[model samples]
Target: MWYYVIPALVIFGVVHVYTKSWLYILLRTWRRDLKALIRFSKVNYYLLKWERRNMTVPKVFVDVAAKHPHKVAFYFEDDIWSFQRVDEYSNRVANFFLSEGYQQGDCVALLLESRPEYVCLWLGLSKIGVKAALINTNLTGDSLVHSIEVASSKALIFGSDFERTLKDIQSKIVHLNKYQFNENMSLSKTLFDNAKDLRVCLKESPIDAVTEHIQKGNLKDHILYIYTSGTTGLPKAAVITNVRYMVMAVGLNKMVNVQDNDCIYDSLPLYHTAGGILGTGQALLCGATIAIRKKFSASNFWKDCVRYRCTIAQYIGETCRYLLATDDNNLVKHSVRAMFGNGLKAQIWKPFAEKFGIKEIYEFYGATESNSNLVNIDSTVGAVGFVPFYAKFLYPVSLVQCDEVTGEPLRDSNGRYTICRQNEPGVLIGKISALRAVNQFTGYADKVATEKKILRNVFSEGDMYFNTGDILMYDDFGYFYFKDRTGDTFRWKGENVSTSEIEAVISDIANLSDAVVYGVEVPGAEGKAGMAAIVDQTRSLDLEQFAEGLRKHLPVYAQPIFIRLVDSVELTGTFKLIKRDLVVEGFNIHVVKDEIFFYDVRTKRFVPLTKELYDLIMQGKVRL
Candidate 1:
């Protein structure tokens, strides 16, 4: 009987491995996807919970604290703060603000790096019904002044690291009360001391006052004034309501199925949406611990992850690229199961996932102020987000044909905007209205800037939509792929060329660490000529091979005409490429100290842009 039982078990195992039985396959998939379905259900539950009760983020934090008081909310460096501890810290911060004559509805500028104190202050300000303008700590001079002034911030709570930056622009800011985060040897020493003293004196603020603010506050009421990265120009103050924060917090956590024991590595700055709200908020929403870092360090990325036993990590494309570029073994070391963020390039997505041993890449698409959000739940490489067939009717996201020259949406004879056909690149827009709960674009602090984003009388009379300013295309499978920004696409040789496409080709060809692709005006060229600023760390680029590869991958018009090799690529604090200076410099060898190369159409190879060739090109003697 024992011999017969062993033989039967062996036969069953063999058949299970080799055969594709319908019942077996069905059970396998159900078992695999059961957890994901439960996570989705949790997301719906949270959304419904928030809708039923008009709960603010601070109120939610308090509720969570009451439920799990001893749960570690945040882990910074070597220190850990529980939910109750953070709540108490925030209460002190609220009392400190109140003690300094601050009141409800007043704006407070927060110029700080990533730290536990930053979170405390943010929650504290929210508790007191104060709008916190999370100013980029990297900003200084006119840019810094404009950001604070735009939010009408009366007081500034900055990290000690930014004392030098604050001192530089001290005279420019008006009606500003400054309080340094830690070590106040410079400005606001008194405020710093008072805040600390108040923390001990007043362990908690009046909860009823906070409750009243929450009761009066609707989803539209501004709680956060987060400024856009403003890579192209001055940063614009974007209003973020308590409801939006809640949505970001709960939506991201549930989508990722973050567990209470899960630890997330967050090295992104607290001023930006990805780090400050979306990333940090997820930790607060779930009873999870976030290992907060001062800034992203490629060398320290995995070391911190392994040390903290992080199961999740956040990223921007540049950060991922930076980590990949490093020679450190830290890239492969760690327990990171998932990564969530936007700006992940199509080419880098799979390699990053494979190399890092990441199980899930939850790429989402949405701008700072835009209401349209698409999350790629399925690991569709290069696709930022997907709208499943079942949910297509529910979501109002659309892509409209855009004019090549003006970069605006094209309308038909009946004044209806034309929708892009399948796989056709077009500007993405989301329908916005008071009636729609999800697709609401509250716009920026500047009314003019906000008004510029709205398209009226599109598709039908009186119809309105929020222009995402992003050119994207959707496949037959309903997976959306970002092509390029409307402003980034340029026309050349009677054909429109996407800089992102060119960059992708360049990345495949040269394996560049960093590349900034942009169109520059050639002296006599009819359209903007393509140029790429590249940082080749190896300093051993094969010019002929690169030229041949570009010719093979891209059309003649789309190929970059000029390439400038730089020591380092300039990027904004948020890791966005800084192209203004590059555009101004163009390919002038004298202006840009970097070695510049021009594509020789006749030779079908790249040659150094000598003075003779430069003059010939500028004088229209040479055809591009």
Candidate 2:
């Protein structure tokens, strides 16, 4: 009897400790992951089914249209387009392309803004096994030519809104056929040589469904070429296969819980992934309605939501901050319950949510070409996503130690990359496997570019992983947080300083509309010194209060050594800050016309960065 009682008591004690310790938290995380995985399995099932049937995106969309023909598919500036209308319009586009002798594997360059027709054009081309190179509409001159030439596009399609842009590059792209789609019935008397009217062609073509036998592509074939944001260099076209499109769409749909009745307000550009694929995918794949805007307007953001009865809205980069700057009149009343996208900083997250009465902020992190993706399902502040410690085998994403400068992984004595410990920042990588659509890395259209992103022999011999080029950290609770880009984090005063963190701090302190931080070389310094460019159109920022706030929020080493005031910050179409030009200009007063200031250690204030001080710093006389 004593032996039995002692064994029972021991078992009870073990259970108690396990439940009381961090293992209990791990259990909850595992439960959350398990639930998410179960939901995601549905996407996998459809993907597998679609692959087996050799069905493409257009085919699936056609089926969805048959089911919800009368439902509103798109809402664009007082114009409502039903599913049936969109489907018929797409059919006419397909017939027109086929009539023009565009065969299977042909490439067509599409330069259009955010509109219902933009989606229909791409969907139509995909139906005939021709891929649409979704060129960024903001691109001009050399960049625009490179985009068109890189894809080996056989034809160019331009919206009437960009007729001048087309004319600028007309001579450069004369080798290819061009078509112009005019919103208004009025046609230009002076059309570029070899350019035809796309509207006339569509009107002449029938609106009936394209012949089933004419559709000649599988789920694995490429459907669209979406370009990466050309922040560091020229935009690289990322291959978007039918399978990849389905995975991205279905994955986001399930994770965000987008219902069929929900109307998604999409003000993002149509050439990018967030707006082009994921936003329109709600309607094309999940039976939801989409409200498309030509461009994102912070002032009219909520008003559009109210007008369209939008239940979900999309945002990226500095959109939230821009919205926060606006007055609270339209923000308070809206039907938007949830907002989804990436780049929602932690500083403004709570304020934006509370002010707008948003119930959830589904912040996510992913590159256009990378297979790795993360979403904060539980609305955890500052967390991009999480993977439980016990569940790493299931989701093969890891943070590995790497060279901070070149962003190359550092291998241990055994020649295997070392994984970072808890709360330690490292380059994020994801294992690539061809066994499933979710794990596959479709990569860029250029083979050299594609190969550069693949990291071979990562954890084990012959194992490949996609280098995400982003630094991230995970805590004891398994919530992963984005730190900064590899090159964006610079070593200062023998400590690594994250520009993103410092930018957030500066933006909050100065009450700035935008802030861009970068590393600039100091002549005698061991490493680069931190510099910040803040948007202050009126030059009304309180320097004294800003310096005080910086002292309170950041460490001495993490504080920016120099600051430049700019009237406006150049941003990408998606609102991401462009730092290439600013980095090159550095802190030279001659090169930079803007007002510059430097931190004064002795005075404990920010003083003007004069030519004398600049020369002193360059000559290594003044310490950073």
Candidate 3:
């Protein structure tokens, strides 16, 4: 035994020495490769020299359009736009903008849908130096006005279908001219030439062609004003410079193995950052085909994948959860091989991939205004595998003893933030400095709102850090997992209540299609009580049965205090439920005509909630 042990020990020692020597060589080579990657990514900055000559973004698109004129650029059901058609439409719109006196560096608010017009307008705006403020078309009243004003937009372009939304905010829109796409262009005017059965090109413009606003704009100059998804609070617009967009595009494409032949079935809304910037930009820059969809449809997701022969796609929220719930939705011939996006849960990752025959699941992390990103590129070459994305993201996050009562970051004996050890959940704050800083909000800076979002001197006396307001945690493998929004997360009695968790659960009420969960003011409660507004896919909700099923699935505090059944849940154009609207309505009969019911705490049944009934219950005139 000793002789064998000695031989093994000697071999181990020799291998250790050789392994260390090889590891050093491997590290040096990786460092060089990483530097090249980082340098190529920053084509607008100091590393612009590394980029190929005459291959700038707009030129790249023009080259592609001229070469692949008949190739499909955008599609929905049967609606289609070829590369040449897209370019021509964009040229016409660019000419339209030029004729309307839109100069370079001017801001234009685009409030439209996922149509050819929107895509052409976006590219055409890029051709000129006009920065597009992709306004959420679903936004109404103050929100819409605030977003438009925040962008300092010189002009607003909206669809004819949104006349009411425009009217609601007409009194509040800043000193800006408005144009209706459907109305301004005569209905008689054709979107494309009727002469060509398959293709069309931009004709010689009788209208004054737009003069080049910027002859040689720096890549660092921002082109898109992207509004945050607003799961936490009012949306803040993020600055996305051309350099950053390209970096992320290349980073994501390389990280996720996106190639020119790959086709991505896009179901995300075009207004969102993921849909336009990360998803579409990755496809365009990587020379991948984009099969466009108007919006997400869980029941038809698989069919769409099969129809497009898509090899990749993007997702967010509990999109997978809904897809999984549609039992038969997974049963279809799909050519999908890989998917690149973010916000997939660990619990569903494996199942989602196995269920769909996906070979790669490239979950990512990056925001419109964030510089740091993590890519889960751990799959083995030609092998089905999994690994989570990892990065410090410019900050050390920990489950410190924050002020539980006021919900603020806490300090310890050392007067420094108490870093939560591995696997503990905590709020994430990105360290801002010369070497690293999240891209700040863009637009004419609104100091009032800007300052509100930033955290000053967080680490030192005068340094600043951007507040992400997202709770995140790292596992043993240094993989960060998303938890919940900071203030939006709540505790109910003895259990932590994830609003997203409840929303996901309630959204699975067999017949319901969507749900938005929020906490509301309740008498005798230390914290707010949970409430949800659900949309019924099977006609409507059964309050009694829903309450019983909810009780079976949830603990006492986790169950919603009030259930409101609505015709449909109102959401942003990006498909995020607008909680502020729901919270304001809050089971108030006068505000919302939806049926409201109260959970009978004792009986575990729901009863119709009436104003008099509420008054009686609050006054102790009624018992649970």
Candidate 4:
């Protein structure tokens, strides 16, 4: 028997080495060498650099404004605006800034929602080398002020709809104007009295002469100053150059297969990177039409897709999932064949394709500050994509050096920057310098706070890397997956706990819209206890069934000890889950309005959250 087992083991090893088969063969094609297989491979869509001839974004609008002047550039409800109209309005708004003494290096802030006016102001500032710093209007007080100062915007253009939020921070701006549209609903002579009539202003001799003399901006200069959708800490303003936008356009058009006849349904916020910097920029650059909505609506999504003949759509996490959760039969009838953007988790990736008949999804990884990007050209599940060769695109991943008691890198005799082994989750970083620019973090209120994020001597002496502060793991083949955030991940009973990994398991439960997993500090305990906050509270929880589900999927330390029921999870402007308030409100019995309960691993059931149980858990008297 021993002699036969030895021969069988050798045969198994040979078989495993020869076969690297996949359920989806095309998804693995990205691993092929671009230099050798690019020409023959259908999956290899783009080269490292797009074009030597610098293509600026304003050139896109200017070309369309000339070629398709009379054709509709945008549509809403029954209203239509032609490329000529967009150019005309944007021109006057441009003149408005110039006449007010705004110049080449000045900062202009955009605090409006998605509208034709947003584009008007965007192009307006681009005309004179003035950069537009788009700020999220949902943010308030200190957050609002922080964004304004970060961009150093001397002038602000705001939508009158948010008169109060604008008014709250009015005293801070250098110069401010509340822009109101004189649309069909309010076209009265009285309504036109106060607001500037852009059409009337353009017809005047002064603005018309200026249109004849259009100034071009340097392709290398920064045109956009946008920020990270700060969920954990203060957001960082990112400087986006014309060259990067041009690179994005080439990459996006190829990845999503955008064409002249296609219409894209976009409701994602323009202030963020996806909508304005990537989506709208690419649409205009590709000569494709866009049907811009005020905001994302789960109920209205399918209907909008159908009504607009939208061939392509952009989505983020929870957006696609919520639309799928609606169980709408009309999903199949819509024209959304290709979906692009990021964060399509593994659970819904397959079902979304099957249920909606989606032919393609370009799930690529890009940030406002990242020089590297990976596009899912071959429909790879759970991959961020590939970075160009110049930077080697090696995501600086973190490796736990030793036990939690020590804070140092575990080193080999080689004395190199020790990182996680392949497929092992760790903190992710990107090399930042004059090249492979990662200029997103612009220091917090304190300059010292800003310097803390910069990691030096990364792989070699004197080399610097920008800390991503995100936990990620990479495969042998260059594909990357997000594990969790550094602060969000915790140590639990001698094991490192990935909060996102645990949430991914628990989120499968019925009626859970979203779930956030974190750790709670317990006295006398060596590590923290895991906790979960599920969004839906209307349906009573079946402890027996849930515990069985979790036990089957997650490891012992990964299983949540406490279950919190929330009506809805509070989110940042970017739709990222907010955990700060939850952590601050911590499971205080008297303060919490929502029902709190604990899972007893010993009993394998959930018990009522009592004062006695809470006290015992806090003192580490109760064993998890």
* lDDT of each residue in 239-344, candidate 2, tens digit only: 9998899989988998888998999999988888999888999899888999999989988899999999999999874577678878765554789999999877
Write model 4 residue lDDT over 296-317, tens digit each, in one string: 8888887888888898888875
TM-score ranking, high to low: 2, 1, 4, 3
Query: Which segments of candidate 1 are over 4 A away from where they belong?
Result: 1-44, 183-216, 229-233, 328-332, 488-624
What are the clashing pairs of model 3? 398-420, 399-420
Please tell me which predicted candidate would have the highest lDDT against the true structure.
Answer: 2
Residues 287-381, candidate 1: write the lDDT tens digits.
67888998788888989999889999998776887677678444556789999987777777887787888899988888768777777776778
Candidate 4 stretches greater than 4 Å from native: 1-55, 67-72, 171-216, 229-233, 330-332, 386-416, 433-453, 488-624
Model 3, span 192-311: residue lDDT tens: 222111112234432233334334555556677877533333445666666656666666666566777777888876776777766677544555678777768888887888887787
lDDT for 331 in candidate 4 is 55
lDDT of 2: 0.82
User: Each model's number of backbone clashes?
Assistant: 0, 0, 2, 2
- The residue-level lDDT of candidate 3 at 469 comes to 56
Compute each candidate's TM-score over C-alphas: 0.72, 0.78, 0.67, 0.68
Clashing pairs in 2: none
Lowest-sum lDDT 10-residue window in model 3: 192-201
- TM-score of model number 4: 0.68
